[model samples]
Target chain A: METRTQDTASFEVTPWEVRGKVDYRKLAEHFGVKLITESELEQIRKLAGGELHYLLRRGFFFAHRGLDSILQRIEKGQRWALYTGRGPSADLHLGHILPWMFAKWLCDRFGVELFFEMTDDEKFLVRDLPLEEANKYAYDNALTLIAIGFKPEQLHLIIDTEDIKYLYRIAIRVAKCLTLSTVKHTFGFTDSTNVGAVFFPTLQIAVAFLPTELYREETPVLIPAGIDQDPYFRLARDVADRLGYPKPCTIYCKFVPALTGEEKMSSSRPETAIYILDDDKTVKKKIMNALTGGQPTKELQRKLGGNPDVCVVYRYFQAYVDDDSLVSKIYNDCKSGNLICGECKLILYEHIVRLLQELRERREKAKDVLEYYRISTKFR
Target chain B: METRTQDTASFEVTPWEVRGKVDYRKLAEHFGVKLITESELEQIRKLAGGELHYLLRRGFFFAHRGLDSILQRIEKGQRWALYTGRGPSADLHLGHILPWMFAKWLCDRFGVELFFEMTDDEKFLVRDLPLEEANKYAYDNALTLIAIGFKPEQLHLIIDTEDIKYLYRIAIRVAKCLTLSTVKHTFGFTDSTNVGAVFFPTLQIAVAFLPTELYREETPVLIPAGIDQDPYFRLARDVADRLGYPKPCTIYCKFVPALTGEEKMSSSRPETAIYILDDDKTVKKKIMNALTGGQPTKELQRKLGGNPDVCVVYRYFQAYVDDDSLVSKIYNDCKSGNLICGECKLILYEHIVRLLQELRERREKAKDVLEYYRISTKFR
Candidate 1:
């Protein structure tokens, strides 16, 4: 029943909270990031060797801070690493996987390493969850992340509490360059906020420069994450030069709409989010009952045509459906009233169920490969 | 040229900064800690099963919180552990070793384990010092601490950055129970304070609870430190019950007076402090030039007695001189104009030089035993 709202005042986005119907362009503008232009996408397509990722091609990953500079550096034969993180408060959902999928593609194409930070500390600080629970979720999420086709050697999983001995030195360095005023302004923190929550941002910033420390070389890092996470990177970018590390380049993706058509899918609301572990029956039911732009009557939709723009089902198709031609056909067919909501829902459900089933299978096999992905304490 | 200030407004004491002349009794009253009473001293003397330590008899370790309970717990056969720490911003000085000397006494007398934290991270956050320099100081200070006669098996050295993997989990739990408002009020943190500085107290608190985590038992911890550090323990005591850990008991000492007769000796002011590594000649020169309460002329000093109560030399004698009769004779002679500043300085110089020489030799030997004193990552 939720309707999209264009009122700029109504929407909110931060690393910790997301609400209302977000206007992507306005959000980018507010965050001082640039929308990824077609020419830039063409440049990436060339770098990717004649094809762009479906997420990038569809404009799901639509914004950036320093993407052009990263591309330039790569062309000049400079090596770069990819860094991204998840606050493990709960199990992985489809919305959470969107950016990781793009990051995996980036690593596969670019032949670069990935530093995956599981911020168990952050979730423990922000959520009512226990540290042990957050740590459990971190291992669980890491298994799911490892299943997403990342080469074990290329992926270095940095669980916050486990890898803190290495991260803490760099984090304190980053923390020194930041003040309470800066974090309060950046994260909208109040006096009532716990000191752990106030200090968690430094851990995130440290991950960006971790490669430079671990490799003993100034390696540029590219982060592909949701636009909501930009603030941490923004603060990182502000302090990077001072800390003698390259400012991390970030490509931001728009939020994946909830099944109820809310701006962002959240794990707190189980009905609105489709978790990666949800069985085929659960996935089918959630998708079938999802919000769509079809008309009230099928006969009226045949005369009036349907609106594909506002439909959560169509949005899922746009993000997950691999074929450009089929997505185009679905868009056209829905607009011409040829495809009804139920048919569209069934199509999206089939794609998701298949993706989840394949992921679950790989996840079961990921246990054996977990050791290879972990960034060991001995690595330091 | 400095004079003792009785104006409460003129003196300030916090974990990071101290100024003016401190009145220990008033400071303890303001901090809501109880002054060590005669009966408490008798209880401790009975526990030692013989003579009391010179520092305890002389009232150098003056104030406490929960000492009675700790004593009662000991009588009931409940073992206790000791926790104390240093912020390794510089090499160890004579002033810095005062509490550690008492901690060694407690360990020797009571057969308790000790957790010694070197807060390199805190110094890196608060001072202009680099992390590496702070870390270097930690090692250097650890050598001196090991030389202080603690049994290697009973001592666990926790260098903040090195042991962060173990400390960080407990720290986050402590941190979650503390708010920005609380730390701001406790530590006098302002908006300009770095987030790392704000979160550093939790590391200190975690040390108090570390034995419970490491040994898997509800071990009570008692901290022996300067009165200035009470705020950190005060905050820890507030949140310990909430975290299901024992509230740490604290014994606070008055600051060791500077050679220049200032309230506290500090490393930044080299003239005021005598470094533990200072050669004998350097120690002699610093002591000879030290401020005293003698008359301007030698003839007047014979007619009018010097003030031992305000003399830095007498204070040093009281703290370091083991012979009770010798300290009392010096005090009475100064009061009766029988002892002059020169003779007293020479007597104190011999005592200090011998102490330093013995410590230096032990410190050199400490390098061999360093491995046994370190709290290894594997200990977790």
Candidate 2:
């Protein structure tokens, strides 16, 4: 219901609205989810047979429902799958990849299948964007996922509009369990909301459980997505048992912050969002202008040090920096006044530039292999 | 807007709700369409190259928008197409075939195409019926339409869930023009209505104009359906200009009254509705029990003449009796109280029994050639 920034402003998060400071712990309480604990991370690390993912270790994916059950199922040698999605509303930004990045890591770590959905139909229905544009965005976003190096055999990229013949059959089964009252309660739908928007949660829920239908068995599913998307899963989980499928478990992630630190990174705000395809100069410029935890005056900053807790740059470092030692040094230096905003920005800019350059090259290569990721074959 | 039956309780008519005494003229006014005038009927007769259809001549098809324009376009050597649909919520009954029968005549007379849609998705969405049941009903309904003798080459049978890929693209375009406000206003939809119900108008609109899209030209279109369905076309016509398609013309038919002389023939009321698949014994039983306008006393009936206008038996004779001379004889005999309710019921039963038997045989024949009428091929 509400996401207050830990040390700053209070905010609210819905699939359509994200504002102010997002207090993950308080947000978890409001959403009625358990915060992912140290023991859970240790269990996942053990299952993965390696160091914990930087996202989990750094508390990016910090809350969950039924993570314990999913882990227990996995420990018992039952296969578990990953479910995540993107709404093709605009160009992909760094924030868009946060859940997907974690999803890919989970698939590799556990050798399980992944269901990646592009909700072009939802965007076309809810947004004023043309179907043509929404379809193009779906393809572009799929390319971004492919660039992250998901194995072709392990991943199933499902575009809603393209594969609806399969999805709609299952979607109708899900839609039957949902009442107009329930969708209105969950999504804040009103008399003026288009019918497509009202019916969309069913499609989202269908994809979450589609793996079980495909495998002809109940495979434990883990959805790693923004906390804003929790309402859809809540509705999905509510209806899963009635539809004779396993309720999907979820690991809710925190919002990857905007450059301004005023809200989550959004495609609509070009100045605040560092897009995946943003050139080196643009990325650097955005990082340099980003709001950080440093004091206004250089002298004041030198004496009191910066608040790494409120820094957007530190959040990016926490998201992308793999080495724990390097992440700790960055946080300690910022808090001890050993690092300045300009120096820290330059370091983030260099790291992001190298990362994006590799991704851009990989995305180019991904164009040729898109057919392999399409999940239509699995349905047939 | 309400439809109060003359000398009966008032009823309401929306696309979703049909009740009360349906005043065709008032219903026309409420739906913002003009009653089809005598002159328009004459014009249609001349275009049809003989006597007008009994439905049109009798004012059963009594309301329209753009009928004159469609006639003019046909006169100018341009083609026109027919569009009509059924929501597969129940078994097809006599009331369901009135429009399709008229549509078949239109296609034959005009040498044009017909797009017959089966809204199984809407049924699955709106009703508690499962997809399998809805799909089965769609097939059953399709067989009945095929039994009406629509030329395979001239008719394109479309099933919504099966042919969604083609429909959805155009539906999205049609949906873009519609706002939540307009659909709510047109269909009397509430917040509590399912989203599929909200979005279904777009699909209906898509099928209405599908011929133009397939031929890649602006072919004039005509819709013949129960007056209850006029609201969908009104919304579709409102958005047609912006979507660059010609506004569809419609001829709204009155509901064939139920056998009990109450409301319309409804599949939900099995005793009142004579289904196409009903056995001979069931048909005879329903007709014998039907309410007629005969006097309570035989002597009083001979003195004061019966009311043919209020007789359900007389209405059925009006619908089925094709010969003008015979129809006049039946009307005159009923008004003069010379024809007893028993004799009229016998005559009506013979006509329907023959009609149903022929339809059943044709329906059985229709089962094998179903693939021929499917429109999915055209889209590919």
Candidate 3:
């Protein structure tokens, strides 16, 4: 139950939802967080060209840093790898899959090796979880990741803190490029515990460079994660510049929202999100409760219309169920009062059921399928 | 640079040291820190018998915890090991060798494995040495340690923090047994850097258990260190008890007095102590400037006599030269005004030269000794 306060501000505009103090660019500039300008974003769209079919429109390739140079390198046939992870705090939720799926897609799209860290050390230093419990959580989470159809050859899943410890010494060398003050400034951590909690972002940076140093030759990395995770790679990119390693490019998409319509679909509240372990009834209950802005009546839609943009279900359609024309048609009809909110939610509910049924059944049959150790350690 | 206050009130009463506001037993007892009482310590001595030597004349190893059971097991022919370190801050002074020499003797007497850590991590973290510089210091320091003539098959050396991180993870688990409140209370550190700084004590504990775990057998350890370091190991022994691992026995020796007649010989002040690396000229200069308890004149010495018990040069003979009978002969003759202080100082200076000459040569020529690496890693 992460509460959302919209952080009320001054300006109230007429007819549209633009507000005061809500300038994304101004906020980004204020914080020195480099964001893609409209022109740079257009350049990305033009550069992606045919790749946009699988990338942009479905929101697969969203946020980025130094992406233009990355694309130029890719165009010149320079390869990049993948970096992603899970906190393993609770059950794996829809929020967790967006990044891993993006990373998996990038692996197929660009023949890149993927490194998935379990970050159990992070949990060890931060959470009160027992080491064995953290280890078990990592093991279980790895299985859930495998069930998502990640190619065995491309992924290296490291769950142990010890493995990461030797790995972190290298990471700290990169981390040393940034001061604790600088880190604390960006992270807003006030205590020693805060430093321990934030230690993984440095490790995340090392994961990008590890392929080049640990594997054989230099391998660049492409991190696919939530927009919330962009700051980690931003620091990674900064550390790379100082440490003389290739910077990791990132594709940070917004999270797939929960049924309750929030910024994130957290698993702490089970009612708002569907789990891979969820049965048909549970999935149905969650989807039916999902928020939608489709019109309740044709006359009301013609009079007041639906705010399809703010709807959580609409956001999901924009993220996961990636049929562009179908979603666009649904959006237009709902906005024009042709499709009602109830009918639209019912359809999306069925789409999710058909989408996840086979995966759930297979997941139930063999819990051991996820425990494939070779797939984890060797990463093929 | 250390001065000992002449306070007969405490007369080596340890339970209340350093201002008496802190409760030693109550603080230790709160975390189930097993506090072996004075009687319990005597029981442990009975069980250990002649296997472990105490600095009894000095009252250094007064505090004990779980030592009775460990020594009982040891007397019954159960195995144990030793753990110690070299900071490589500078060349080893007489004070540095006091612990290692005693440790080497214990290893010989008890037939236990010894682990010598070259604490480059601690040196770098605590002091201002770069990793490369710290490593070079360790490399150089290893030669001096090898020059001490420790057995090749008993000591394991770990210098790189990068290598030690995972092995340290087990120790960090014990450290996790401690809270920030506990560690801060013990160390009085107020920052994140303090955690890594104070972690060496935990590393020492892990080294104590290495034979049992790493060698894959059931055994304990006896950590031989100066009394100043005893405070740190008290916490380590506490962690061992909590983890169901055997609590390590500790041998706390009194400090070897500086040539300048201070309470301790410190490497920090060049004028105060003779270092292993000191040449004949430097050694002579240090001894000539050394503080003495002897009277300035023949008239005063004949009238007041010398305080040989507090004489720094006399302590040197007691710590290093091994011929206690010769030291007694000189001590008794000087106090009676039969021997002059200058003549005594000259004799002590020559003993230093003669003592270090072989070591300097061995350290200089020991480069070709592949045996040193074996000794360092305890592989031979």
Candidate 4:
């Protein structure tokens, strides 16, 4: 599945950073995860009452570690819950919301609970930002998650600083099982790295087993995150059996591409990302300026056609275009020179503007629902 | 201050392990703490209303970091509390009780609150003990502490596993300020050391600043512990001002010597330490077998007398005998030919039996007092 493109720049990916051109298939191999097979997709489609989430159907969440184990556990009548998180180092963007949207879909389709972690503590440990600033980002990110339509009763939104008691005790046990060398090798940490940073893999790993502790049983968990985060869960899975908890299954997603098609989207690069709260005008402007794989001029574009394989706008269409037929039509039109860069930009812009306008309204309404999702109340 | 004795084995000391012949004065110098001076003792006596606790008066609690600053703050009418802790790795022993006893005296005289941390989590992280077993030790240690006559209302007994929320938020901030190099150099940690062990200094450091956070002001804290634990508070003091909290002052104690006259009394050495719960016969047997600085033969012992300076019995008398006159008499008798090893062991045996019997009674009575000291209820 791994392929190299002649014109595409090579890339590197880690939990904290991404650069150049990322190949999702190559990342899957490098991380030792399997791409979603047709059988697995059919199994999920059948389990979701004869349909699949757009993210899954379009191969956005196309990689996994233990999805088959989760399916088998479910078939045996055992329940599995979803665990995912936000680092909250910056404002929420569509890239951040993508995984949560899929998580919400899983929650509704499978009728399972969700453990949504806001790692404000990790943000402070790993970034140069102040603790208070990280806390502010956590609050802002929580609202964006609430706006994503997750059912309050089934969701446990955990802010690391506010609900640290829930994680820290178990995290110590997990940390003991982990070695400094393992983290150093896995996460590229050096002696110069802060101790908090060196110790943070445990905090991230602890979230996977939280449901088992809460329910007082060996409940299975499904962690849906970008493939970049696989190392922590891989370490968690390796230790879970020794700790007397079930190994958590992982479903990995490809990163949302940057607006300029450089690589993955990031809040640190505002010009390359579209924030969740961006206005329709702002969303349109960003998409219009976004990178695409068309020829240099209209004459060459018409004669040679375009390369949608490297187009940021085409990737957006794949992520947001719910109708499979429409997505196929957009791809056909772009490859056949039927759609120019300006036309494709218009199409992507319309979709993003509509999505943001609706999300902004829901985000305004979600303020009242935040309390129900906050797990800080469960302990305190 | 550094000295090498030809017959004395060279040793090293860290918070985790102790070896060889430890020189108290050298340890003070090595740890960058000052030995208690006559003037400071006089100030403490005046502050305690013309009396010093036996430990302070006898030079058991011998060194300090900021005792002068604490005294100055108290003179300026600023409030301060006492913070001390035990790692619950084994059963409660007199070596563990010595500092808590001194802390009790400070609490009674100055009417300050006590933060007694039972680091059950630390035991699990640092040792090969199960979390449940560590928790069991914590309960046993808490009962022994309760038996020591610290008023429940003025004491807050925090078990790290049970009251983690209070410590973790602050610990993260402290952890962030610490670097891997600092901890590795300070704690002598290697790559094989678990992440929990590498990260635990912050947990220990956080207790020093908890009073400042809880009281929401510049409340000073006094940590009374063995000089071995000085590194954690030293690191705490380095970070406290930047964190906007008053630096914690320390009153360090010399290690209580083992019955074998080895440098330290350790719970890991069952034959060396006298457990508070040891039966009367067991206590007498241990004292009878204890090492003494007497001549090989009774005839030579009578002619040459004994060295009370290095005798375990004389040190025990110093630790347990409340009356200064009684301790002086015992010292003088041992120095001259007036007291022999048999008579000294008998006298020490009688004192330990009485002390243990009284403690056993108080321990039975203390079951009812534990509820008031536990901070678990504050969170639950």
List each candidate's DockQ score.
0.86, 0.42, 0.20, 0.79
Instruction: Kindly report which residue pairs in candidate 3 clash with one another.
Output: none
The model with the greatest lDDT is 1
Query: Candidate 2: misplaced stretches above 4 Å?
Result: A1-9, A292-310, A331-344, B1-9, B173-182, B295-307, B332-340
Where is model 4 more than 4 Å wrong at Cα?
Answer: A1-9, A294-307, A333-340, A378-380, B1-9, B295-305, B376-380
The full ranking of all candidates by DockQ, starting with the best, is 1, 4, 2, 3
Q: DockQ for model 2?
A: 0.42
lDDT minimum window of 10 residues, candidate 3 chain A: A10-19
**Candidate 2, residues A1-380: lDDT per residue as tens digits?**
12221333577788888877777778888888899988888999999996688898888899998999899987898977999998886668888888888888888888888898888887888876777788899999898899988879888988887887767777777876766667877777765676677777888998878888788888868999999998988888888899898899999988888889875887788998888988899998899999999999777777889999889999899988787787789889888888889999999898888889888899899999888889976557
lDDT of 3 by residue, B1-380 (tens): 11222134422213113221223344333323344456655554565453334343224333444566556766687767777777776657767776776666666656666777776766665564676677778878777776676656655566646346435556656656655445445654444443344444455556666666666666777676654455556666667777767777765555566676655665667776788889899888888778776898877877776877778877776666666578788789777876667778889988988878877877776556624454323431
Tell me the lDDT of model 4 at B131.
89
Q: For candidate 1, lDDT tens digit of each residue in A130-183?
A: 889999999999989998999877899999988888789888888888889888
Model 2, position A78, has a per-residue lDDT of 90
For candidate 1, the per-residue lDDT at B243 reads: 93
Q: Give candidate 1's whole-model lDDT.
A: 0.87
Candidate 4 lDDT for residue A2 = 16
Per-residue lDDT of A161 in model 3? 66
Q: What is the TM-score of chain A alone in each candidate?
A: 0.96, 0.95, 0.81, 0.93
TM-score of model 1 vs. true structure: 0.95
Residue range B1-380, candidate 2, lDDT tens digits: 22221223566876666777877776777677888888888888888897688888777788888898998987887977888988885667888888888888888888978888898888887766788889889998898899989878878888988887767767767766676667766776666666667677788888877888888899768998887787778777877888888999988888999998877887777987898888999999999999989888777777777888888988888777677787788888878978777887898899999989999999999999988899875556
